[model samples]
Target: MFSPKSVSAALATHFGNALVSPAPSPLTDEERRMFSRLKILLTEKEQGLIESEEEDEEALVQESGDSDSDYDAEEDEKPEQRSRKPWTKELCDKMLEFYRSKDLEDGRRGASQSFKRMQNRFRAHMKTEYDLTLLRKYEKTGVIPSVRYSAMRQLASDVRAKLGEKMKKGVPIHDTDIRKIALDLNKLNAASGNFKASATWVSKWKVHHRIVSRKVTKFVTRKATKDREKVLKQIDELRIKFLAVVRKNPGIVIINADQTGQVKEMHSTRTLAEEGSKDVVVEIESKSATTHSVTVLPTIYLDGRQHPIVYVHLGEPTGSLPAKKAVYGNKNLVIGASKSHIMNREAAARYFKEVLFVQPMPKHMLLLLDSWSLFLNHSFIQGLVPKGHKVTILNIPKGGTSLAQPLDLCYNQQWKCVMRRLNDAILVHDIDFVLHTRDNLLRCISQVYWAFGAPMFKEYRKYGWYRGGFLTTHPAPFVTPPKYMFGEGSEADCPCSEPGLIRCPYCKKAHCFSCFVINSHRCA
Candidate 1:
């Protein structure tokens, strides 16, 4: 046996000093080129020598260990090894074929178990020399080709297409569609039966198709032209009646009354514009204060005029003299207390004594004031009405004055005009002039009056009377006049004898007696 070191020394001696040289550095260019080429050839030769030496060592080990006796022992062991059964390529092929066929009756029951056993043995053998992973490529291509699965999927797709086409063409219909069609046909048959059962029996006409051809008819009822015309005429009559009623009572007056404190320090101012200018503005101002000692009850009448009257009454522990004197000194208007104001006889007497000093007792004057506690519940009427004069109290609903009262209408209109005037005034004189001139106050009063008076105008129009005429003339004073009058007189004295009267219904007169009397009375 040759030792590695001895073999290397012998080879080195045979090759000489040329075989082993010191590594070069900073060689000439030509020497560098030559050395590079020789290095590559020497590396290949060294590799070949190393492989040959390994082969020789293996051969020597085998030769020295195995002799005739060892060969005989190995031969005797080979039979036992053969009996142990090593897996061969033929065995693998046969096992794979049985697995692929799935022939269990042919004695390959546990194919997966047999496959695992074969894989282990083959992998052990391959690991001794080559890698077993290389068999994975062969298994993929030959044993389990992916194209077979793809082919099966393509066959299923073709079957589905054929079935879909058959379904579309109304051949081989689905069970559900067939059931639906049967049910529909059955319904049709039932309908036909119902028609046949109700149909009249005619000997000559036995045409079933003709009867089936008839569709269900829907009867639509329509109004006749004559009926429509009648309805239209009725509607027109109703419209005319409605119009007549509206014309008869064209306007309505809503009244609202609320009271405020005394309008303190009332004053007015006049303004002059440029010489040729048409504008002349007036301003007014007033102030008020609140006090707990004296309760000033203001009665605001919202009819044809927005007049707010104030009455001061000393409340709680205050004597009648102080209250009465205070009210009298503050305002010209005075009201007397009645028995109703008395909580007791003493209070009644005291109230009477104090109030009587300013005004006579039992004067029934209707105060058109707002609905306040002082004005409501007939407090004012009971307190002020004289013993003999009958006081009739009227209360307007809340917020209704704008619609029912003459004063609210007038006030609204006047206020609107005043606002416009104030705006114009401000534009001309600047903001400071508004405060100094008291234009805002004047505008407010004007607006209130306009709002109150508008309702009166509307009422006048509705009643075929002029508001201006009534206001200026002061007809009937505080009371409304009666609609009719009658008197006994001879034809000569009676106004009915005049030529203007033409057989009046009430008097059977040929002359206009009522008109003549009305005109005369008004003039007087």
Candidate 2:
């Protein structure tokens, strides 16, 4: 590939100088090095390996003028930018990869991620992107580890085939699962001791195989499958009825309420780390956190108003708080309890009698709720309400919550995102507060819900109403809270005065990754 005109002329000058020297004269070091280079050029030119014009003895004499220094300077660098410490570790960030990003989502990641993070603070690493690019080149040349280019191609092919076979068998495919197979194949191919599956390589394999990450949350029943058209008809009917109710009481309070179990650990799967960094470690309060559960019923008001979540824990909601943070015991959430760590009929009835019934609620209202077993008991509910209060209950149809419920559109996901971020922050900062405990979970949920109800999330509320077939007008200029939260939309700095780069899902204010994780992140 070295066919520069200057380089060809420089080589001719070296040969001419050597020929003109006295007979039997020993060659100088420079002349000897130039002759070696000249010989390589001649051999390649004859083999048609280079595109440069062929030069004979006369041509060498005619093309003289350039010096050896100019020849060395004019030579283009080799395709490899700089030698990397051969990829010796496993995992995506540090491993060799070949991700072909075609779509905006993937392409935005570029050849590498944009930011670098450390345990203490955010540090800017300028050459990481360049390293990522070089890693790709090394992968192509079979200079990475000991496996050749042909062997890698075969490994990819084998992994893809294995994925298909597993999918056909109804087995789940996880990101780590891909690495497991690659490691096995690497051993089979006799790869060097440094071989590790690059996270990027897995991504490239995913892209090439048309695979994407997905959560499995739903299943089809035989009866539903057989009566698919009937099910569709039913869904349409439910939507029509729900929209009618919305139209009927335009000014009345319409509350969409449902309960969900909180992720015991509450850690986010995503995090910011130094690009090309291996083994990002995230710690949590305890593994037992995932074993216990707390129930929360978050509601979305029609007018983007705030509401206290009704949270439940086992026994009574009681626990000790740090002396410095005793405000956690305040009325941020309506806390209740049950023997099974959820609201049962008895626990719910008691909560209604002691907490909800005592509130000065609107005289006339409509409640949109799911068909929880307890909610289906009309007699029990009617007996608890005051005689004059006009609280109409409209139960969301069975299996209709997925489509007909307003909060399901996005608000629930956003709420969870807030908690996930906070939970991870707790672990990252090593806060002593055990979040899964009844008292601490109550306090955190209260803080999160307070943030969640902010006016910044008004669009999220409107989005749920609009997408769930309840809104007559378009809620334009709104964004999905979860996706938007991941962006650098915050205009302020973190409490620590760093430039904000990530927005709080609930507060919609940006904070640098360090402040968000290390410092206590709360609504300002």
Q: What is the TM-score of each candidate against the true structure?
A: 0.20, 0.49
Error at 361, model 1, angstroms: 13
TM-score for candidate 2, residues paired by index: 0.49
Give the whole-model CA lDDT for all candidates, comma-separated: 0.29, 0.54
For this target, which candidate reaches the highest TM-score against the unseen true structure?
2
Candidate 2 lDDT: 0.54
Give lDDT tens digits, candidate 1, residues 1-524. 32344334334443463334432234455544555544544554553311111100000001111111111111111122111134345644554544354446777654332445545655433321112222332345443212222222222233333323332222322222222222223233221211111112111111210111112232222222344444445434533543454355444222233222212222111122223445433333212211222222222221233222222333333334434333222121223232222233343233333432134322332333334444455763466445565444444333333223333333233323333333322332222333222223323332223222332233322221113111223223221111011111111123532323111223433223234322221211
Error of 1 at 66 (Å): 99
Query: Which 10-residue window of candidate 2 scores lowest in summed lDDT?
Result: 55-64
lDDT of 2 at 514: 50
- Name the top lDDT candidate: 2
Give the clashing pairs for model 2.
92-199, 490-510
